[model samples]
Target chain A: MQRKLISGIIGILIALLIGALIMLVQGYNPIQTYAALFNFSLFGFYPLATTLRNSVPLILTGLSASVAFASGPVNLGQPGQLLIGALFATVGGLYLDLPAFLLIPVLILLSMLGGALWSGVAAMLRKWFNMDEFITTLMLNMIADFFTYWAISYPFFDRSAYSPMTPQINTNGWLPIWGEFNSNVIVMVLAFFVIYLVFNRLTAGYEWRITGHNSLFARLGGIKIDKNYVTVMLVTGALAGLAGGLVVMAGPHRFLKGLGANYAWDGVMIAVVANNGLIGTLLYGLFFSALQTGSLGMELITAVPREFIQVLQAVTVLVIVAGRGYLDILIDKTIARQKARERAT
Target chain B: MNIITGLINGMISGATPILLAALGGTFTFYAGVFNIAMEGMMLTGAFFAVLGSYYFDSWLMGIVCAIIGSLMMALIFILFAVTLKTDEFVTGIALNLFALGATTYMMRQIFNVKGAFSNPGIVPIPRIHIPLLAKIPILGNILSGQNLIIYITVLVVILSAFIIFKTRFGLRLRAAGYNAPSLDSSGVSSAKIRIWSLIICGVLCGLAGAFLSLGYVTLFSENMSAGRGWISLAAVILVNGNPWGIALISLLFGFTDGLGLLLQQYMPSQFTSMVPYVATLIALYFYSIQARKRKA
Candidate 1:
């Protein structure tokens, strides 16, 4: 465990070094750019708040990806699920004339259902047709993107709005705010807490781990692997859907084209970087969010483009994956040496 | 007649890039590598193709540069997924992300433009005019005057069919997918074969990218490869990486894509744009059912 953590940190340092090299090549001072990035992202009040806000969807999506990955299937359908969830939330917010207390919960539930239903199609396809979820989910993402665009542009078109977006959702459906921060942070926190408990304490978590490690073994152990597959997909889909709902409710308060953005993919990256650990996902999500938020500041201060942050994120993921293997070999050799010394003594 | 001819032309052009990428993907798929980085490879190729053409004013140089760029991406994938034993899917996703960022950053840095780059200096791949074929019939109208890459794609499809079925390397490639340990015991390095397959995949994807930028559009735009890589992947999966199957599926998808383009006149483009993906899902569904029946 210590070795793994050390390797992860080392990987991050190497990634940052690569970022520095790129900046240097571009004729910018890496030190100043990085300094401005951290200062604008975390050290200040407004910047920290913005980072936290940006992290909300990431946290939910990260947890979603974590749950899916920790089970058997690779759910690349997060973006599609998120979009469907947001569309459901938008539709509910616009049409449902309920009080804030009732309406918010309804929207959330609706969003989760929408997400579940979207992923459920992929899950069913896998179960009944023996289709690979990876391709189906990816195809679903494209379909969902265009489907939502058609939905908003045609049926839900707001005549008064200039862009392709649904009308602003009812104010009652909006997430409550505390100062600069929205209540969506609470949702993110609650999600992390629940996922942590599920993975560490629940029997279902053990079954999921077993299923992911080896489904044939899981079946032999009397675990319902097929049921677990569907359940896991639904749960992950709901988490991603909740993220979409939170994005709509917390800000914008309406369905917009390209609303899913890169949040779902970023979430998936965080899950991989964190090795699908709940706590690790949270930390990595926050770190990535900070980098994303800070990139703008870095750009303004140093004339460096914000897209460099994406390169940094990708490099970090690659280094962590590659570094872990080398780290394991080193750890194994050290263990062998210690055993030899103990035997001599 | 004019509309039909235009749609047929669109289908051939649309299918060419997808067929090229899928043909490349077939190598990696047969080598048992779940390489989903084709998108990144193609995108990187597209950018470099434009960059090389813009600088050298030669389409040949552009193709060479594209292959180099794409090979670099493949090298990264092999280093992590093959050599380091990291999860192939994770490495692929990261590479895609890296390609997007790197290409976008380079476009800004080198071209001083955002979103897209195009120039008169950037030479497009020339179209081949077969005058005799053009005078023959409707077939001539559909096939003649196409870009050089279109003809190259046809030759590749045929050559790939031959290589995958008749060659010793093809046997080893399939063996690597079926049973790597058995192949290793036979003194054939499965890892080496896998690496070679990926390298080949990279080269083909590079060609596909070059065709997209230089032949299809004559420019490099952000995400210009779009989801063609993913679509190519789907084609590979649906057909189980059979070269002929890839050709057929790509043509089917190309038909939908061309139909979508033609339908844009009568419908909202969002719905029209969805035709190919929707068709892919339906085809996959049917293919799965067929496979299951065969298993039974």
Candidate 2:
């Protein structure tokens, strides 16, 4: 907890310093900019809801990314799977004339299946051909994107419209809202707990860890490493797919092409910064959510361009990475010095 | 004749951006860094190129600005990934997100454009056709007429091949990627070599970015580079980190892209655009099988 807090403090300090530099360059008051960023996000009701709304898909995507990373395979296809999931969810909602209670779960389930099936291709390649999942998944992301664009722009395009999106999902299919908060928040909170249980305390988590640390060792110990790989990837894809469903059913009423909104990438960032831990991902998800929320308010209130927020995010990562770099140098130097001392002694 | 010209020109133009970006990725791979941020870097480069050209009214200035901008990014990446030993992939993704958001915000702030920008003064690279080459029928029209960047891309491809295969530095880079500790033991600073390779990569990606904005479109748009970075990465992987092979693979993708455009115009627009992505998958599958066979 202390380490996490210290890291959080360090991240904030670095962000503030960069914000100051940017303000100086752009001729804006740094303090005012920072105040605008926070005031609109935490204090304003609309902004707080928007932040939670933006974080809905991210929570799932972050969990998906963290789980995959924990399994030692980078699932770079979250964007692709999520897109497919959204499409599936939209279609399910549009065509199915079922009760709201029954329809929502079905849409979620089918979307998860769609995402899992899409990701299975990469998993199969890795297992059968020893293909690098990173490369395959990344490539598949574009393919998925192209597929969605084609679907919306051509066949499914609300041809009656100029927008690049499908018709809005049925009102019955829309996820219910509890006042300002979308009901999807319930799903997100529940998933966080589930992720904690599965990752932290479950036997499945131990199996995953064993396989992730060393496939050879896992295989030698009679664990079905290849099967684990396939299963784990499917689970990762399912979470991403669910994220897509959440976005569509809970937030956007229609299936907009590019709804991925780089969420797959954002989720990966959250997971990476969180270091593949469930709790860490949850915290970082909220932090990133806050950043996005604050940036929107900053844009509304001040001339501080949204790009500054991007620069701030980049600066945050850069500072973190550079800090790690110096730490690496220190460790290497220490190791070398220890070797020298051993020889001398 | 017009159709043939479009196909040929499209192949050359499309291949140029990917070839350069893949080469950039190749340099980082040699240095033992994945550099997935190429997409973001290319977008940043393209945005700066347009911004520079818009302000200075000079393509040369745009190209220079892009190179410098992307190189700065490369330097930051090297500082973090090499010195800090932070997860290379994480930093790459962060940089990409930074580029996307920053570029979009800049477009809104600076140009007052939401998604795309086009203006009269934003001149594209003037096309050039060889004198003797113009006499030839199909090949002349297809290959001869292109912007200045296409020629540079072809030249750089050959140059990169030569550098990778013939130079001692190339050998050291390859050695570093294969086994960094081994190179460290040999008194070669693996970090320095990696940093140099990344710098070279930055230059190539910058050129690629300039090609997209100044050479092809004459305008900058939000996320205009699209997934070209990932496609280039696919090209690099498909070629197995070989410079010559990478260029060839990029050309193959160029042809697929051309085919897609052609189909989009002539065939049903919907299914035609899917060709390039589908082709990528098929090519990747083939490449992976070949790789597996070789390993076996």
Candidate 3:
């Protein structure tokens, strides 16, 4: 934990350095711009609220990726899964006639099923035919885009609406919004504990770890590698789908195309940054959400582009990727220099 | 225009970038690294090529800029993946995001443009019509009048096949993927081979990117590679990382995309647009099933 914290701090500093350089190149005062962003995200309630809302999909997607990464498949298809979830959830909201409370939960669960089924496609391919899940999942993202595009542009497209999105769920089905943050944040918090329990208190967690570390070793140890891959993907896909569902039922209230745009990739980054820990992933998601929300103001107040946060986010991931190995190389260089000094003296 | 001719032309245009990117991807795959950064490198290449042509008014200079831009990205990948031994996926994915954001920011800052830019001053890559081939009527009509890069891709595919099968360097590169320890013990330095192959991949991807912006579209747009990088990776997987296989699969995917364009008049544009990607997934599934069958 100490090592991770130290690396995290180092990683943030490197990201900041890159962010500052970009600001400088763009002729903005880096310190002032960063201060403004932080001021909005940390002090103001509205910005913080926006941050919480923006993090909903990310937190879920981060959890999704954390599980997949732990179970040996690095799923890059979470966005597709999320979209599948959102698409179906919207369909359920429109067609299903149920009481508000029951219908909302059913829609959320259906979204989870949608995501799971989509990921199952990738997992099944991996299991039955010995395909690599990494590439398959990425390929599925594109396919999912088409699926959602078709759903919106043809079947679910709202005739009265100008954009390619489904009509809003009846107000009864909508999760009551709590100020700027949606009620889904509550469910997201609940999910954090549930995921922690699943990872720590279940035998399946052990199986997942073994498979992730080495399939050959896992099989020799009597773990069902194929089953574990399929299960993790299902759970991962469910979480991803629920994220999209939450956006529909609680936030956007519509099945908008491009729902969770880039959030799937962002989730992967958060998982890596958080080192795949459930609670850590949520914390990283919040941090990213704050940056994303605050960057909007930064663009208006300063000349910094909102997309610059994306650059910072990517740089942060890169620094974390360069973590322990990078420090070891640095220490080795230092030690070599000291030994050379001793020899000369 | 004949529907057949238009569909074939669209297919060639659509497939050219994937073909070049996959051919570029072949090197890194042989060297044991999944070059997921191909998308970003290609995107960077596209942006720099446009900038190159926009400023220099010369296609040659544009290509040069693209190569330099993509090579820098490749070197960054080498640093993280090879030198630091970082998680290749994280580095690759981050580099991709960085490239996307950086290019968009630069496009806004330098060009005073948002989303896309097309400057009339920029020169496109020339189209070549081989003299003898032009005389062959139907065949010439179908094959001729392609961007110079398309013909170059044909040569690159054949050359890569020969290099992979017959050359010492190619053998070592493959050994890096299949048996790195033995190659290392043989004093071949797998890291060195990995680095060099990635550099070559970068150059080829650079050319591919340039082709996308200059040859096909004559414009640079935000995320204009439009997941072609991922499609190219699928091509790599579909072929199980072989040069000739990459070529054939790329053409097949290209045709699928062209068919999507042609079928737009019949079906909903959204559904028709899915042809290439849906085909990619199916192709991967069938390829893996075939592998399993052969093994059994």
Cα-based lDDT for every prediction:
0.91, 0.82, 0.86
- State the RMSD for candidate 1: 1.9
> What is residue B47's positional error in candidate 2, in angstroms?
1.4
Worst 10 residues of 1 chain A by lDDT: A191-200
Q: What share of the true interface contacts does each candidate keep?
A: 0.81, 0.65, 0.76
Mark the 10 consecutive residues where model 3 chain B has the least summed lDDT: B134-143
- In the range A1-345, model 1's lDDT, one tens digit per residue, is 686678888998999999999889879999999999999999978899989999989988999998889888889999999999999999999999999999999999999999999999999999988888998899899899999999999999899988899999999999998888778888779877877788678999889988988989999999998899999999899999999999999989999878998899999999998888888888889999999999999989988888889899999999997788777877889999999999999
TM-score of each: 0.96, 0.93, 0.94
Clashes of 1: 0
Per-residue CA lDDT of candidate 3, range B102-121, in tens? Answer: 88988988898888999898
Rank the models by DockQ, top first.
1, 3, 2
lDDT of 3 by residue, A44-105 (tens): 78777778878888999999999888778878789889989888788898888898889988
Candidate 2: docking tier:
medium
Number of clashes in every candidate structure? Answer: 0, 3, 0
- Candidate 3 has an fnat equal to 0.76
Q: List model 1 lDDT by residue over B32-85, tens digit each.
A: 999999999999999999998889989999999999999999999999989988
Question: Could you say which candidate leads in lDDT?
Answer: 1
Residue pairs clashing in model 1 are none
Candidate 1's displacement at residue A59, Å, is 1.4
Worst window of 10 by summed lDDT in candidate 2 chain A: A319-328
C-alpha lDDT of candidate 1 relative to the true structure: 0.91
DockQ of 3: 0.69
DockQ each: 0.77, 0.59, 0.69
